[model samples]
Target: METVFIVAAVIIALLLLSLVLVKQGHIGVVTRFGKYHRMMSPGIHFKFPFIDNVFNKISIQHRSIELEFEAISLDQASVNFKSLILFSAKNSDEDTIKKIAFRFIDEKSFMQTLIRSIEGSIRAFVATKRQSEILVLRQEIVDAVKDHLEDSLNHWGFHLLDLQINDISFDEAIMRSMSQVVSSNNMKAAAENEAQAQYLIKTRAAEAEARSIRVKAEAERDALELKGVGNALFREQVATGLAKAGTIMDAGAVDPALMLYTQWLDTMKNVAAHSHGNILSFDGSNDGFDKTFKQMQLINKSLLEKNTH
Candidate 1:
């Protein structure tokens, strides 16, 4: 019975000694004989009672570090720049985090060094580029720095997620000058655009007006040509009719006195049929047409009688 109780107690102590609680989002590295044996993931884990040792525990979490400082340009101008760096440990094991904890400084130290290096690089970049280019290529400079830092720090078991410039402060005078230049450029572009729009509108309006005038002139010319053709046709018809009448008269098929007497009888018949009352007609200033007719008849009768005798 005593031997069984001692055996049970020893088993309980060994079990207790072999058990280890690893938290969530963490990994534990076990080492044996001062060398890496295996890595244990989160939750309860077991190890040999005396042979295995827990070396280090590491977190698998992404982290961020912010840094801000001033840098001087090649032109002796002070620039205030602030940046944020996102980084994470590539390995999250007991041994790796332990090594990192002892061999590597904290995030703040790393961020300071990173910011200093980035500032130096930006300075060199700005020296080669104009101030305008610097402003335009600020993102490029940031990316370059991030790439360089990631490459350098990857060996140190760290991965750079990103590095970005939050703000860049310039000298007041330089800022004002830049603002003025931008304002002037915008104003010039606006004026040029306005001028171009005005020119296009005027050109279109002039073209439309010219087309309208041309159409009106063409219509007037066509109307005048039509009118001239009509007038020429009427004059030709009148001339042709007059020529035919003259030819008929010259042919002597009908006497001139007979034509005059026919026309006079037709005129007197039309006037009598349409008259409202009796009309006393006169020949020019003669008192009556009857008296004029009597005179004409007497002259005709005398001529006729002379011919007969």
Candidate 2:
């Protein structure tokens, strides 16, 4: 009876050792006598008691880590970055699981390698770029790191799901200098805009003034033309009146010279009456009086000849 009870107790212990439970989001790696045996899914798994070992249970779920590091730019400026990295196992396949389990001695070693590799990749990229270009090249930096780290991460049975460069910063002095540069540029732009607006206003004013001057000149020209026409009509009417008066005086048995002299005297009297502050100077000698009389007799004679013809 003692031998029977001891054998049953050993069987029960073996059964307990053989049962392995892999929880959700986890996969189990089994090894037989220090050699790889098989993979276990997330459930109750049966194994050979005392023969197979559960080496490591790797979680296949997504994981994340934050990184902060410094890099030197091509211009030899120190740049700091805060980044986030999201990663996970490539897949739950046996080949991928093997690489994840055997790539490093432990989780700490793997994490160290991953973080160092990311840092190295970022440093390499930063070493080729200028400090001024770092902020704008955030996406490019991420792409370069991805392309550079794809095969390396794959070799370790992990995928680089996402990489984010959240903050890029420079030294305090460099930041202040950049801010001053931006301010000066903004001031220059504003000054140029103001100058352009003033120039436009001046140009419009000059154009309007020129247009007004042109319209005034045209109006003056039209008024002069009308005045010249009126003067020509008045001269024609005066000549007609002189011819009619000379004919009437000749038919009345009066000397035509008398009528002409009388008309000249009346013209002088009217000029004297209506002259405001204007001077009416003439040759007042005997030669001037005879010359005026002769001119008046010639005018009457010309009118007489016209009537006879």
Candidate 3:
């Protein structure tokens, strides 16, 4: 009865060692006599007792890590980058799981290679760009790193899911200098605009002033022409009246000298009526009046003869 109990105990221990449980999101690699044999899926998996062993359990889930590093730009400026990287196993195929299991000595070594590859790719890209271009090339940098790392990671049975650049920054002095450059450019644009505006204003003012002068000169010329025309018309009317008066006097068989004397008297009366502070010194004697009237008569006789001719 004691021998039977020993055999049963050994069987139970063998059974316990043969059964393996693999949790969700994980894959178990089985090895026979320390040599790779097959892969075990999640849940209860039976293997040869004391001959097959659970070699390595690899998680197929996505994993993330934060990275902070510095890169030197082509312009010899230091750029700091903060980023997050997501990675996972390529697939669940047996060959893929085998590659992942045997790619590196351990998870730590695989992670080191991955991190170094990412850093190398980033540094190489950054070395070719200027400091001013680094801030806006976050997506490009991520793309370049993925492109450079895709084949390498695939060889190790891994895939790059995502890469995020959280922050990019330059040195304090460089930042201040960049700000000054932008401010100066804005100021230059403002100055150019102000100069153009002033030029337009002055040009318009000069044009307006010239137009005003031209208009005033035109108005004065028109006024002078109208006044001259009015004066000419008045003189013509007076000449006609005098000629008619002379003709009437001659028909009546009256002396034209009598009409001349009456006109001289009328002129003196008008001068006296309209005089403001003007002095009129004229001869009041009949002899002086007769002399002046004779001169006027001579002038009128000559004008009438010329008109008749």
Candidate 4:
């Protein structure tokens, strides 16, 4: 029984020593005779007991790291910038990742190296550019970093996913000055707009006044012309009426005295028709209406006899 137990223990120990397991999304590097033999995928894997070794395990998964750096502007002004970088192993080559992993003990040291490279490149980029250029083309800087990192780190099995610039802080004085200048420019523009508005309003008012004066003058001129036309027409009508009256007189062949007496008699008849029984005081020598009527009839009859002769 003692010999069987010892044999069982030896078998178990040999089984444990020869077996290797790799999880999902992971690959194992198997070394034989102290040299790379082949790669093992996720599952139970076998290796020579003492000659073959599981050198490294590499994961084909996404990873990210944050990076920060300081930059100096064109005016020798310093600025602080921070960003995040997301990367993943595109190639599942365990040898390549193992080489990279061996250079740096862990993910943090590898990230530190990447951060230093990024910072150096970004600072160089910013140092060559002016503050205005940096402010205008920040996206261009990010693109450049992404392109460079993707190209440089690809051999290390890292595929760059994205680079994000989170925050940027400029020198206090420069920031304050930019703010002041922006505010002043806005105020100047506002004042210019107000002045232009006032000028337009005044100009429109002047034009309106000028138009009003012209209209008033035109109306006055039209009224005077109309009055002159009316006066001429009135004079012409009066002259025409007088000429018609003269024609009637000539047709009748009557003396002026008889015509006047006929008109007076017509007026008296009209007055009598309107006055029903009203008493009318007369200016006479107490002889009354009979005396006045007899005189008028005598005068009218004499004028008529002269016309007949």
Q: Pick the candidate with the highest lDDT.
A: 2
lDDT of 1 at 75: 65
lDDT per residue as tens, model 1, 96-181: 56555445446466556666766676666556655555666778878777666776666566677778888887889989988999
Question: After TM-score superposition, what is the CA distance of residue 299 in candidate 4 from its true location, in Å?
Answer: 28
How many angstroms is residue 259 displaced in model 4 relative to the true structure, after the best TM-score fit?
12
Residue-level lDDT tens digits of model 3 in 1-309? 999999999999989988899999999999899889999888899999878989899889999989899899999999988888898999999999999999899989988988888888999999999998888888999999988888898898988898888999889999899999999999999999999999999999999999999999999999999999999999999878877888899899887778877887898789888989578887879998778878877987787789889
**lDDT value for model 4:** 0.78
- Compared with the true structure, the alpha-carbon lDDT of candidate 1 equals 0.72
Stretches of candidate 2 exceeding 4 Å from the true structure: 1-17, 215-309
Root-mean-square deviation of each candidate, in angstroms? 10.0, 6.1, 6.2, 9.1
Give the lowest summed-lDDT range of ten residues in model 3: 255-264
In the range 1-309, model 4's lDDT, one tens digit per residue, is 999999999999999999998999877877788777888888998887999988777777777777667899766878788888887777776656566546566767777778887887788788888886687767988987877788777766678888888887788887899899899999999999999999999999999999999999999999999999999999899656644654587689854444444656777778878987776555556576457656765875674576579
- Global lDDT scores for all candidate models: 0.72, 0.91, 0.90, 0.78
Question: TM-score of predicted model 1?
Answer: 0.64
TM-score for each predicted model, relative to the true structure: 0.64, 0.68, 0.60, 0.66
TM-score of 4: 0.66
Top candidate on TM-score is 2
Candidate 2's clash total is 0
Task: Report the candidate with higher lDDT, 2 versus 4.
Answer: 2
What's the residue-level lDDT of 82 in candidate 1?
80
